[model samples]
Target: MRYVKLPKENIYEFLGRLKEYGTLYAPVKISEKFYDFREVDDVKKVEFHYNRTIMPPKKFFFLPREKLFEFSISKAEYKETIENVEPFVLFGLHACDIFGLKILDTVYLDEFPDKYYKVRREKGIIIGISCMPDEYCFCNLRETDFADDGFDLFLHELPDGWLVRVGTPIGHRIVDKNIKLFEEVTTQDVCNFRDLEKKRAEAFKYHEDWGNLRYLLELEMEHPIWNEQSELCLACGNCNTTCPTCRCYEVQDIPSLDGDTGYRERRWDSCQLRSHGLVAGNHNFRPTKKDRFMNRYLCKNSYNEKLGMSFCVGCGRCTYFCPAGISFVENLRRIMGIEDKSCPSEISEEIPKRGFAYASDVRGEDI
Candidate 1:
């Protein structure tokens, strides 16, 4: 609820001051039309006005590949070895990613706690900025586009400068500790924030919503679109790897050739993989690519409903990264009988998958 003003001209000065609090990691431009979160000392390297990052902040917290423990080859002994992490601040996050972090928290910390992820959450601070949406984004329709919590500080972009909303004690300390870098918020500042919120909500290019989809998706289990879309699915798992909410990973234990010592590691896994549903003795439960593809939708739409959240969050990262050109929204629209721009004029006809026009605002494909 607290508001403060940051002049665009002095924004770098503000970023530089944050290093006084901890090591800083913000969105840095990797190339034209590509950005990623990286450690930075120079504030000028940060870029906020981006459509999206190649990956989300989960890369840092959850870790794509991490050592879970070490074990002896000779004995039945093992010890947990989660890494000890240091305090740091992640700046320039988009609101959807911030909410994405919240969904991660719900998965790891709520019922069966993940000690490693919980520790990372406690050690890190989240600072997000307002972002514009492309056709691939629908976080707005699911109401995950804007964040009120899950962030230490949320910045609203404006024509003049930035309006910041402080959300936690750590965020307050950042402002209070560097009082000289920020100025008092005026009445006009509040109006600007309001204007930006209204503008952001209306900015999303894809907003076809079909109400609570938990039951709708369950009833759609036998829908024919699943069979047709599976033809276009490559099952590469780019969707799960790039998605902020797809929390699936596989654990492995690697033993030394000499049989002296071994270590257990956990790496990110994708349900779309052929081995994802494979069991002992080589029996795969979800055998077909279509079964795997439909499972992703069911898990997002129905399984997480009782958690009081629509798991998709409508980030649209899945469709953007799919090599086979599967658009979740477009596919969902097909199942729900809603008209989609990507669909053919004949609803019964199969959708022609998109080309590798990944960067095109309208043409869709996954990263």
Candidate 2:
């Protein structure tokens, strides 16, 4: 990989020049302290300094709702529905989101290979920027703060200018086109970059014995912490929606008025709901709120180890956006008996009055 300097004077120049590549999309501030990834028509409105977007850049590829195909209601005829899309230039993605996309690539591209996701993936050029993390960030635990791979270009901001890493041919092309804007790298520049990495790491508020967290979670199933967390949880689906790694989707058929044609559509779904695992005869596997709640952590802590990758990258969006104020790290520590967790002030507003009954008192009994 080669390093090049993106001069501050050329920042806007770079955005204007990037329009030649494809339809440019970047983070745009929507309201007070909120950002969304939207199409860029004017460079003046693009947001550079932001903590995290409300939604990940994955929405461009795996859309929230997608129509799979149309089928005749009477006859056994079907036709696929896919748009003839143009190329997309997705810019200003942070390192945590980049690593989240990497984890998703392992599922959608590497394992089962979803064609629709692959189509959009190939059509986009990703450009990543270094993050200025907030108190809600714990990416340091799993090295999700920066990526060594998975982006065409990775930009690191410094006191003077932006340090850009050349990863793919697309990145090289950008540097080639704007050769005057990027300076030749020196040994001192590399040393300064290393210092930036250390500074970022030291900024995190939480630390973990990464290799031992899974084992710590494995040896317990009856922690009262899970029960208390469940009572506080709203089961509102915010965590699943905000999380970039939770890729569960639901499929359904919508019929036409004439009953001649119908289309099957798939939309983003959450595994946290009680109805998610429900089947015919009114039977549900994970009937209790605690069962559904703890399943999320177990999947992150237990199942991800089998895949040889960390699912809980600790971007901390789930806790930040949660109405119930459930912090993953705090609760995990409580489960492992790390920090003493008394009843949080956020939990006293409204307790979950009713919960589905289970045969056992232990957490995750139905899982």
Best by lDDT: 2
Tell me the tens digit of each residue's lDDT in model 2 across 114-188: 888888889889999987667888888776777888899998887677889999998999889889888977777
Could you tell me the lDDT of residue 136 within candidate 1? 90
TM-score, per-candidate, Cα-based: 0.89, 0.89
Off-target runs (Cα >4 Å) in candidate 2 are 303-307, 341-367
Tens digit per residue, CA lDDT, model 1, 210-254: 564556567556655678888888888888888888789999989
Deviation (Å) of 213 in candidate 2: 1.5
Candidate 1 local Cα displacement, residue 361, angstroms: 38
